[model samples]
Target: MARRNHTTELGSIACDDLTELGAGKEGWLVDNPNLLTALDTHSLAIANHSVVLVLDWSDGSDPTGPRVKIRPTLSPIESEYISSVEWLVFDDIRVLALGTSCGYLLIYSLRGDLIHKQIVNPGRILKLRVRGTKRDLTEDTSSAEICVVMPGVVARFDGSEIQSMLQRWFQETHSQFWDQKKNPVDSGSSNVRLPYQLWNVNKYGSCADAAITGIMPPPLMELQSSQRYYCAVTIGDDAVISAFRLAWWDFTLC
Candidate 1:
């Protein structure tokens, strides 16, 4: 016979498979094995197989207890085996990203709506990391970025564009014209669709003859300079470390 020991720290909830959550205190965002938790103003996003679940945890009276759940429509192909998930919070809006075992990355809005999906690498994505600061000294500029690591490759997606599309989708979904009929030309236009641009900016093959094991970005302070350069460090299976630098300006122009 097997006995399960369930012990938790003070103020912590003892739930099964409470995997991930963003950093906060006033309200909590959590993901269990089957259910996800979200506050009243915000929705919790979780990926199971290919389905993304968005739950509202605001009861107005008791926030710690289970509240309500919302189901969003997803495409049949989008519901593959999810390998990893992460939340990207921009100001007040939250975006959920799911990485599939088939090397596909799917992005979703806080309302559980699919924002964008793309095949980032030919191999399975081992991990997903969101790098860079949320805001820079230039208020008009965006510094948020998403990093995806595979067997021997590292890919990056522009977070600013993803955020812009989510905001547009959220507004359009809530607007009075969301359900209105539109002309074929207006509905079939490619410009109206959200773009999933995965830039294969860097590779880790030349570092070693072995498979690449890990990839990481340098600290924010190290990358902040007049030239605006970013650096990525990768570890190879041969026990070798290689560093690569990416600059905003072209080297030929300098």
Candidate 2:
């Protein structure tokens, strides 16, 4: 009931368990090749369009045990379907983020309450990828970034922006501890505008999916420019697989 990608180290539950998508349902699994879901040690949160469900693996660990379903909070009567989900666990913060068809990021608390929302793109979000890198002894490869991929665009959000905003959000409510049982009284004040980097990557045709794997060191013998360079890998029917060097000016690596 799992699918493994050796190249990206990405593993997904194929189908059969029930609380979420991986419960042996080939039809559902086959239809959702990208899979709108996020899996963590304690639970699996999966979405079908706008409907979201959280399945706790360790029943006793969470009081809302087994199953907790959530419908993203949108403007009254507004319809926005979820395209991707990502779980962020940093320090004492454990929250769920949903990427919507309207290119919005909706962050929710464990209790299934919306905490924050930010517009990321004008197009539907294809996927939300959360990555954290460790500092190597020889190089400064440490960085935490969320890769938000759209059809022909890719954006990145710094981990620090999210970390601080969540911290500030809880503080605004005068609560040092996160309470899963109730919604914060000051929830309205938590809408934060975070700065992000967006790049148009239409060089490889319209990409079905894409992510910035890492910040590469400058090419050998090349002067290190102020701009941080990244390698963008895109998947599409036209190219199957295409690689591009993303800098101030785009460079094709194919």
Candidate 3:
């Protein structure tokens, strides 16, 4: 198993301590790092601090082929800090979803373009995952969703709907900025509201005092028509596990 130290102390180390430990120099450390393979498996993303590294491994299992660096596009006065990241792929499109310590979720295309950004939580996001299956003509189904997991809350959003909203937002913002007759200040900013269904495991009668830390959707087989229903599971820091069932209709939770 791969292991890494996640602990850090603010105090300085003595020279004698370094000499006793092979005289090594001090180095920076990462807290709560995350790594995951994209759905395609040909790509991998690693997040540390305020940057994410997207690596392609198509050329014969080589670890060093090409790397793309992705960073949050913040205003000059804003700070950039990433806490987690996940891959979101739909049909022929692939994008990276980054979660920040300040409750911001930023989505970026493979070419490092900022596609969409929003604040999904009031606290740090602990985990993220893209749920739901692609549109299937033979099965006559369409269900694409994104799941955002944070302390004490699990928010679900429709993936296709979000994509549509972002496209419209980009066009309107661009036109409003260039129209000199209209006051740029009056153009008004777009705030993507939480078009999400939230699940609070804490309110579900769990005795655990800790907040929710992770969540996952039912497996694909369980989501099929044969199952007749869909479910999700959430984990809490205090070792409490909660499961929820929702009626499925036309690829949505009813």
**Candidate of highest TM-score:** 2
C-alpha RMSD (angstroms) for model 3: 11.3
Question: Candidate 3's residue-wise lDDT over 39-78, tens digit each?
Answer: 3456766556655666665546445334566656544455
Give per-residue CA lDDT, model 2, range 72-97, as digits (tens).
Answer: 66544456678789898777788898
Error of 2 at 87 (Å): 1.1
Q: For model 2, what is the error of residue 177's alpha carbon versus the real structure, in angstroms, after optimal superposition? A: 9.7
Candidate 1 residue-wise lDDT at 213: 24
lDDT of 2 at 201: 81
Better of 2 and 3 by TM-score: 2
Prediction 1 global C-alpha lDDT: 0.52
Q: Which stretches of candidate 1 lie over 4 Å from their true place?
A: 1-80, 134-142, 176-228, 237-240, 247-254
lDDT of each: 0.52, 0.72, 0.57
Worst 10 residues of 1 by lDDT: 206-215
Instruction: RMSD for all candidates, in order, please.
Output: 10.0, 6.6, 11.3
